[model samples]
Target: MYPVIAGGALSAMTFPGQTAGLSVFADPLIEQLGIDRSTLSLSYLIGTLLGAAAQPAIGRLLDRFDARRIIVVIAVLFSGVLFALSFAQEIVGLTAGYVGVRMFGQGALGLAATTAVAQIVRRRRGLALGVSGAIGSAGISLAPVLLERVVSEVGIATAWRLEALAVLLVVVPIALTLPRPAPASMEVQRTSTGTIIVAGYTARQARRTGMFWVLTGALSTSAMLSTALGFHQIGLLGERGLTPLEAAANFIPQTITALAATLIVGALIDRHDPRIFVVGSMAAMAASMLLVGIVTPGILAVIYGLVLGLAGGALRGMEAAAFVRYYGLTHIGSIRGLAVSISLAASALGPYALAVGAEWAGNFSQPSAWLAIIPAGIAILAFMVPQPSPRATRPS
Candidate 1:
């Protein structure tokens, strides 16, 4: 758990910087190199798209190989790429290196980190995963702010060099220290196909059933809204008349609130019906998005921020937890890979849709609530009480 938390925290540092990799290029490169901004974005986005599709295959391989070793090797390679990026003067080299980092570091590394947690913990998986995720959340909150300070004080090249070194030195030890002990008995390995650990369906059957639809549909819209707004919240809030400082203040508590939400929801996920947890989470998420469109005064923004933060943090953990409960450990890799793919694909559409809406309206007005409605609709649709798959337990 300690290694998981520490490694997750460090893994998150590269996200803010890599996400804006194109901007990290010198302006002279942009003008002199004739590289299209569209091409850079496409390369970055496509790498993650491929990562989503590749997750299951990676998961299946990890199941057979020494995943602990794989993670350490990948982490080392990721650090090497970051270090190499410092020397790339052309857009092609930079974009290619950035793409590699995003795919292996951000995308594949996520599967290794989170799925490894699920494999280790049986009881209180939610709480453990929640805590691990919060470590990453702390990184998300701190990375951009920290990078800004670093870049202003130093330079982008020097800061990135320092970042690569930090990852090499800090994350390597944590990754190397992950539990090497195997499951105690051969009994776990023999469970074939759809053995039910949690509910009606064996893990395999969950993949082929309608319940998966119900579950996926439940949160898609909420996901859409959250993904879109996450990129633009501070600016959106500022436009509503809040000062930049006030907008920034709202984000600080939002991170803490998200952490609290994940912890609480994780604990509840263990005890409560998944249906209740799923629907409640969706509704709370919708309310947050709606609130984002309305709150400009007093504590409404704070409260809204809290809701959004919790929704984001818990939702990721919940999706993992629910599937774990539904599917058990046998086929978790395959099912989760599919789930990650769906969510990532949908998320890809979210930002594009927001851009389209903004273009249509000439501003980002009124569309916020409308954008949120889709996820709410999904939540309502998922409430139709899916018939649990008949095998062991699984959600595909």
Candidate 2:
């Protein structure tokens, strides 16, 4: 429970550096810099792409050093980045700030928090991840709202400066309290599919397995679809004949369903095989896309929110647990880092892909229907993948 609480707190610390947090200042920044929307987005994308590309290295560092020490450094640096962002006067300044925020805040800080908890709790990892994810998610949800209020009162620059101060004064102190443990000393064993325990598979070895690719593919696809839809949700809802208020109201159902599903999935994965969650998440994603693509508004719309929310919540919980469950924690940081990079790259591509699809098909429904086929196929294939043995003997 302590590790879980720490993980959740660290996750919340990512708010100032995440996309939602940065978005609040977008309008004011653009207005001040005299740039168009496309230009600003392009700058942001470039920065994010570079940051994503560096995740594997960051993961290696986690494996090589004390996570608590690393997290403290990252938090302090992230604060500096926010400070830099507040004083940006040109495109280059914004780009540097974006890189700092994405690389340190989103990538390294987030990775440290989760990995710390995973290191601490071996048996009930599912529950720990579930609680941390839920708390982290709540932090993300509140970030934009909080930033908006601050921006309104103090203005964007001052708001950012305050955020920077909060990170240094609040986040770093909490980070210093995190536990530091020695790496696992368990013996290594090789299996038909992958290595098991202590000397866990390196990122290269992990990628060689069918299970690794499938799990990564499933997660990447989820990230792509979820991010794309979220980016255009209001517009999509309007196309379905919903007023602004109705569309906003749908978030209530989604949030409730997501919270409920997260806790349930968390508890279940600890007791049962994790593969069930993989299949369930795939099915929920497919159901969500199909529902939103075809169903009429009214009650069905709320149902769509529930299914979508479940998919998101469950998928996140499962993905976090799967790395340790299937691959072992010896080098979990490096292995998970590669997986996260792929997911982030997919997220970047999703909006563009969906936009192109909408333009070509003349409506979101057609593209959404097409997108639904991806998870459906993955769901069929997930069944064939076997559960990895927790510890296997080395071949002699």
Candidate 3:
């Protein structure tokens, strides 16, 4: 219970590094810096890529050292990065700030939070992660609105500083309350339910398995498409003849549906093959993309929001639980890190790709429709792929 609460809270704190959270400040930064949207997008791309590159190393550290200590350091560093970002006067400073926030806030802290919960809660990991993911996602969905209000009241720089202060005040204390054992030294517990503790595969070994790639493909596809759609939501909806206000309001249905799906999927994932959810997520993503290509100001747009929410919510609910279920906790951090790095790298490319495609194609629809093929293909692969055996070598 402590682990779940800590994980959810920590996950919620990752908003500053998320694309949706950053999107709130986009127009303000552009106006302040005298840069165009494309230039800002480029900076985000480079920063996110560099941040993604650091996850594997961070994951290795989590595996070897005390996760609580590492999370505290990351939270403190993330707070400092937010504070520093409030002072950016040029693109270099902006990009540098993005790198720090993305690495410490999004990449490391989120990974640590989920990994911590995965380490501590083995018996009903799916339900625990589902609750955690739902809390995190709800907070993420609401952050932009709350931050926008703050920015309106206090101005951008002060809002950022306040965010920094909030993170420092909130995260460090919660992190300190977590268990102090290093992941490598923690003893595995078995219960009367015949839970066999096994040594998880190394990152290298996990990479070699077909199932790893299948899961990665599904997760990466979701990350890429979802990020792209979110990063350009206003523009894309405008292209389809919807007012900006209506477009923004569409997120309400998406959030509600996402929360519902996250809870439902989370509750059921423990008793089922997680691959089913992966396939379902991909299918929903494909449908949502197709819907985006044809969405308008009426019921179609609402339906699109609901479907997209389903895809994102289901994926989030199952991801951490799937990894832990398939791979034992022995080296879970490294394995999860490798997959997250790939997903983050994919996310980094999404907005830029969509921006380019929209520019070349004269609208968002054709590009979105074409991109749907990626997830559609991955869905088939997820359905056909065999599940990996969880019984590996015993933990050393």
- Give the candidate number with the greatest lDDT: 3
Candidate 2: what lDDT? 0.78
Q: State TM-scores per candidate.
A: 0.82, 0.91, 0.95
Query: TM-score order of candidates, best first?
Result: 3, 2, 1
Clashes of each: 17, 0, 0
Ranking by lDDT: 3, 2, 1
Tens-digit per-residue lDDT, 235-260, candidate 3: 89988888999988888888988888
Candidate 2: the clashing residue pairs are none
Residue 44, candidate 2: how far off, in angstroms?
2.7
**Residue 370 of model 3, lDDT score:** 94
Candidate number with the higher lDDT (1 or 3)? 3
lDDT against the true structure, per candidate, is 0.63, 0.78, 0.86
lDDT of 2 by residue, 69-101 (tens): 888888888888888888888999898888888
Cα lDDT tens digits for candidate 1, 273-318: 6776666667777787677667875688888788887667667557
Measured over all alpha carbons after superposition, the RMSD of each candidate to the real structure, in angstroms, is 4.8, 3.4, 2.1
Which prediction has the highest TM-score against the true structure? 3
Clashing pairs in 3: none
